[model samples]
Target: MRRPDVALVAWGLLGTVAASLALAVAGQLPFGLVVLDVGIALAIAAPIALRLLGVVIPDVLVTATLLAAAGGVVVAHTALAARLAPRDLPLLHFAAALVIALVFMPGQAWLRAATNRLVLRRSRHQQAALQAFLHTLSPELGTLECCRRALAELVRVRQVPGAAIILRDGEAIAHGDFDLAPLVHVWPRGAAADALPARSFGTIELRALPLALREALVRAHVTLGAGPILSPRRRWGHLFLNTGMLGGFFHEDDVEGFQAFVAQLALLLDGADLLARTVAVERSLAHAEKLAALGELAARIAHEIRNPVTAARSLAQQLSREPGLPWVAEHRLILEELERVERRVGELLRFARRDELRFEPVDLGELARATLDALRPRLDAAGIAAGLEASPGVVARADRDKLRQVLVNLLENARDALATSPSPRRVTVAVRNGEGVATLSVTDNGPGAPAEVLSRLFEPFFSTKQTGTGLGLAIARHAVEAHGGAIVAAPAEGAGLAFRVTLPLAETP
Candidate 1:
């Protein structure tokens, strides 16, 4: 710091010596005048010396300081050269030097501000950081790696106490000289807590944090501030930074610059999230299409084999009924096996068919009552207390037999679910009509399906049971969809599963 001041002072002195020598060579001034001129030049150069040493001065202060220095120089020079005649006195040179000093003061202030801005704005380090960040943020970059690179680049270029953070969804990554363990460990807690400031980006206090995190910051001798990285659509995460080393606080400009960087990062996060979701959706659509193709093939194969299976079953039945036949016992077993295959083939046919519906206005209340009555024997045998509730006037447009098949399938499934339950076994069926739709729900107090099983509950050939052919719910779905309705299964309010079927209502005539 002192080196620049020394050099500036030496240069000023050399200029003074050269001026003295030039005056002597020209024979324009006596020794007394030369001395006065040199003294004034040095006095006028005082502010320039201060500037060279990197001091920021307000315009008003600069003007006042320079004016004082100039006035002092003029007074001293006049008092020292008082013996010279008034006309011969070098007052003109002193006055000219004072004017230059006054001009230099304001000019230096403006020049300093401009130069600082140019240096900061066009800094090669910041540019390099941006380029590195772009290179790392290419489409090929993984989402987590992009976040990590962003943090690393910001921390490296900014040269603070090593601070950068990014969080997308629930995952987070951080970079800096300070260990991120404190923040990383607390992320789930921090993210879930509602105390985070609502500001988009700014310094946020961490005083209310957990003991371990606050202690970690204190031990590292750093004061931390949190800034939320957010786009207009979503908030990515909080960026925690310690802007200075040795626990120094951040200035307002530091906060603003950090916010700008955070905003850029938030956009990147948003793009990454959108890209991931797009890829997932595309994969899901492709999978669904593949499943549809498979189903069509299965239905075609089932249709072609139906005639053959029926012919074989007929031949086996004839063989079993043969009068005193030697192979009667073997033929009976074959006939039984044929019956099982026929039942399985029937299920496959029902699930694979997407046939057009035959909608008809049918009373759902009477249907619900009939279904419960038909299943009463099975429910009583399984020790399941079953009851049904159907609004008297509820009606719907559905294939009566198909809708009855759906209700029968759902009730049988519910009864099977409750068969072995150790808990209280009770099944309740409810039917209601409102808002232009009739809803039928079968709820059972049995062990409910888990999340993993619930996800594929309605998928064809996907079932949690050991002996299930996995087509009952699938067939039920087809039956309900054919009636222009929806069927959904979810865990009931208590520890049970509830299957709700909604069908569009037909006005009672």
Candidate 2:
């Protein structure tokens, strides 16, 4: 022992002996009573002395000492009572009971409190660790960022060298100087591990793991300690700590605190996910509102321009008929340009005006066939083969004109898409009914649009053609939605674009 420790021990023993002798002499107690009193004093002083020397006494040892001292006191009191007269026995017994109540009980309480304070010293900082972790949760940070920051905070609070968070999707965010890849590869999988409650794995437990996992952990110099981050709905991820190269382990208090922290982290992650989805929905709603306002503005502009364009076209036609006016070809070109403007204005008006649906049971198969027949001449002129594949009695609850307009727009769109394709180009319109829905698909053999272009196909005023108003698909979508249906575009089976429209099937009588 060091000189200071030895000197302190000597002084402690001397002081204890001096106090015991003083109690025996001053109280005139018998030798046996004096020894009993010395024993009791030592039981009470031992803990205080050890604490002063910075020694942490366990709760079990403290409890055992208190119980032993309490029993010894009772025995000493009984022996003293035996030496007393019969009349004084009851009074001595009463005094002994009072001493037990006033001393042993309170001493036990105090010692337990002191021992817990020493043994669970690290646990006292759990609140601080949690506060630090909570501070990392900021609205400006994303889920992954929050996770990384939380892991960083954990490393700091737990005094571990490194930590990592492995998400359910195999995405890992690591903080600290540790090899996370090997740990990730050896991470326990299957439902068993997922369903496990929060727990710690010490050095022996880690070494006892499967050969591959143990080898990986040993190679990476990481201590295997993890807690699952789970939610009522699904498993979020796992939190891992690298205790150190010495294969350290977590204390019971540390494990409990970690479990609480991970639980809080799981809640935050769930909230972050929910917030992201809500933000996306909000953005979609904002975009829709903007588009609605723009459509209204376009409608007003088209209304104002339509009147002047009509008057100009009428004047041009009249002058052309009167004679070879000085510039007849110029007049023809002016008339053609005016007609294009009028056509665009008409489309804009149709798009803006929400007409009441004239719902009726319409045969989708017949509609497909009729649309194909009406456009067959144009398809033939363009050397594009058009065919209809219809299922008998395939019908939908729709407005015939609106539904027909959708089909015409799709067919025309398909025809235009095939304008530059090689010979033997084909456009197939298929109509089928199943599961209380009618599906109409117009597919063609042509160069399909890229993914970037495909995403914006339904947006207002978004067109691939140079002279196209870009309102065709938009109008089609609006009409279909009015009838409580939907329209979608995708790449065709071989090479081209496919437009599919789904509408509710007509109810049977």
- Which candidate number maximizes TM-score? 2
Error of 2 at 157 (Å): 5.9
- Over 1-509, each residue of candidate 1 has an lDDT whose tens digit, in order, gives 12333566667676776767777777856873666576657745753544332223333355565567667767766676776677866675676577666657775665544443342222335645654575558544656777787777776676554664536455656566655665665554334533455443222456556666566555433344566777887666776665442223334554566677777777776778788888889997997787688678878888888889999999888777778889776887888888887887888887776767777888888998888888899888889888888788888988998999899899889988987897568999899987779999999989999888898898888877786888899889878876889999999997899999999998566
Q: Give per-residue lDDT, candidate 1, residue 431.
A: 93
Residue 64 lDDT (model 1): 67
Computed on alpha carbons, the lDDT of every model, listed in order, comes to 0.70, 0.77
Quote the lDDT for 358 in model 2.
89
TM-score of each: 0.52, 0.55
- Candidate RMSDs in order: 16.0, 15.5
Off by over 4 Å in 1: 1-135, 138-260, 312-340, 357-374, 387-410, 427-459, 463-467, 475-509
Judged by whole-model lDDT over C-alpha atoms, candidate 2 comes out at 0.77
Best by lDDT: 2
Please identify model 2 stretches exceeding 4 Å from their true place. 1-131, 144-259, 312-338, 360-366, 387-397, 430-441, 483-494, 500-509
> Could you give candidate 2's per-residue lDDT for residues 28-84 as a string of tens digits?
557646665666566456534543333233555576877777798789997898789
